[model samples]
Target: MGGLSPAKRLYQTIIHQYSRTINCNSSNHLAQRLIQEPISRIKTTLDSETVNKSGDENLEFSWDSLLTCVHHHSPPKAQLVLEWRLEKLLKEKEKNENLYSDLIHLCGKIHDPQTAMRVFTSMESNHGGKPSSNVLDALISAHLSSNNMVTALSIFETMQNSDDYKPTAHTYNLFISAFANLGNSKAMLAWYSAKIASGFLADLDAYGALILGSVKLKRFEDAEKFYGEMLEARIKPNAVVLHSMLVGFCEQKDLVKIRGFLKGVLEHKWRIDGYMAEKLIGFYCELKLVEEMEWVLVALTETNHNQDLDTVSQIHNGLIRFYAKLDRLDDMEYSVGRMLKQGASFRSHKDVENVLCSYFRAGAYDRLDVFLEFIKDSHELARSSYELLVAGYRRAGLCEKVDLVIKDLETQRKE
Candidate 1:
């Protein structure tokens, strides 16, 4: 069905593939299948035709693997499939707040808060279930996520007035974290104050929110103070808290602090994703701390299981950027060679352009020949490698040294 929407297509596929096993009239097991398994193994209990009824024969159908082949896709696409499935299942399931809450959270994640609100409102009247704090959080998250401020606040007011439920510390932390993300430090601190006034001792989560807010607002001192308080209270900082503080320190170019804390992070081997890897590497490069940069790279390499290719690529590109900015052609070539040796890629076209621009800017036409020859000799350049050399010269994407590049590029392409 090329004409059908992605979600609708998934629904039809599931209907055709597993119609014998699923009961649309029952919600609980269906909802569990939606979440607990990918679409491939959504059916926990199989049919007689699918499995051996007498338990004497091993069925060789491999329906699960076949379904996996049908449904295997990117995470967001899979989530969309689940969302449509949940929407249909919600109408059939009753007296299961857990499922309802989970579906509401998924709605929030997928940016369909209106549907989440519909699911929330339907919980008691239609499903005969009393909504729990989990449901409340999901409902609030859905509204806040969509920036439906007035409606979200109205829901909060209703929760406050409810005799059956009261807003908990976790609830307030949700608001705090939301405001922090929205870059509204004032509102974030207001929620933090409200949380404290409610007599709930601020925990790691609450402090993490405050520090994140402080960092977003560039109030480095405030972030430091919150971090210090967290340590004093003997609450171990999680990745978010530490990363936020580290980011603030980096922005201020506080190399001393980065050195001390990064040591601990490496010692504990906390995971660093691409963005964080880029930031740390670029920060060290700014300070001309090449030895420290190398140390960090080596450490990351040693703990490379946590480092994805994108993360490793960014690390290499950051060094390339530093060298390009300074016209350190020899050092840049050496860094690139080292990266190739380590099996990391120079995937960023911007970095490649930066290198070409540097060569042009420095008038190092002779050295550029060696650099180009060095890269071409690697024998693994992607398709755009020639375009950046040949097409770049033809289009003036790089200038002042085009003749030699063009000649060499044409020769390389022919051979």
Candidate 2:
């Protein structure tokens, strides 16, 4: 009777152990078993079976099947399987470049630099294969993943010295991102400068990282320079890049720059998401620039057709509050109406009070009555409106209207 093939035997062993652990209701134990047992035993069992059956030194273990079997496990365990398989393959004198790359990447994923370097060395010494760019990337990424910038940079420098391996854009981006993560703008800029000197045009991602790193280091001038370079390179700035610039401008209170950038953004038809729009509006509001605020709000609302209800509400709320502050009652009323039309509610009593005061000061009693009627069902807003009206009536010695507002307030409270 023929026993199961080595691959099938490994699969059945995994399944039986998994089922056994599951039946015992110990999922953690099952996980431990999955991670610890199968790959460890697979090599020994297959080796013994192969020797006993066919006296064939080459084991028929399937790398694809092994990878598939361990695909669902955590990176560490998957890495373990790959390591075991690689060790066995090396013993069998099998030289697979792809397998070497796969194991290096697996080690990188787990940030296992020690193991990754071992795999790199083994690929050279044991398999007699020159390290490809893919393997080098994996090794560098492993160091980056571990946040070991020194070692990563060392490896990168080694790659630069290699006659055969030229670092890709991805390699430079990883270095840039790693420096940015460290908040070392100088180091990041150095990398960018090196990349430019290498005749590599900075991609949008690289530009963005430099812009953001400059902003982080409070080098707003450098950030602007990078942004200008990006534009000159004809790489269109996305919302993220533009927003970072906007925030940097706002931080410096450079309204002139902000207005210019916003004009270009609007003219270019860049997709302005709600958060960025809201931030720009907030800046305009803080600067007390009503026209700019209104223009940005209208442009963003028109452009962002997919704006969610909450974002719309926030937009209207900002407009209403700003208009109320400027005593622009008509604009406030328009914003409120727009908000209502968009299925958003105004809940700011302070804004409602300001609107009522504006209406009273302007002697728009008829409009006030209509506005009151519109918000009559809103208990808190109506109460605030009535109180403001009552206060105004009392100050003007209109005792009759004061009594009337007080009576309406009492009636609403009762209801």
Q: Number of the top candidate by TM-score? A: 1
1-415: candidate 1 lDDT, tens digit per residue: 8986443343243234322322212233333344455545543332222335566433353322332332343344334444443555555565777777777776666556656755665565545445666677777787777776555665566567666557888889889988988989889999999999988998998999899989989999999999889878978788788789889988988778887777766666666676678678767876787777777777778877655767777777788888888888888888888888888767756777778778767767567677766766444444475556665455644565467655656776798
Give candidate 1's TM-score: 0.64
**Candidate 1 wrongly placed segments (more than 4 Å):** 1-87, 110-114, 148-154, 157-163, 182-187, 193-204, 231-239, 281-295, 298-312, 349-379, 391-415
Candidate 1 lDDT (Cα, 0 to 1) = 0.68
| lDDT of each candidate versus the true structure | 0.68, 0.70
Error of 1 at 230 (Å): 3.8
Model 1 root mean square deviation, Cα atoms: 12.2
Stretches of candidate 2 off by over 4 Å are 1-131, 285-291, 301-314, 321-331, 340-415
TM-score for each of the candidates? 0.64, 0.55
All candidates: CA RMSD (Å): 12.2, 14.0
Model 2: per-residue Cα lDDT over 1-415, one tens digit each: 1575433332233234323432312333333445556655744543453353457654334444444444556555566655675687688676777777777766666566667766766665455545666677777777787886666766676567666667777788778877877789878978887887888888998988888887877889999998998888889997668878988999999878887887677677665567676796678887787777767667656765545556556667778888777778778888878777757777567767877777777777778878878866642655666777888888777898889889878887888
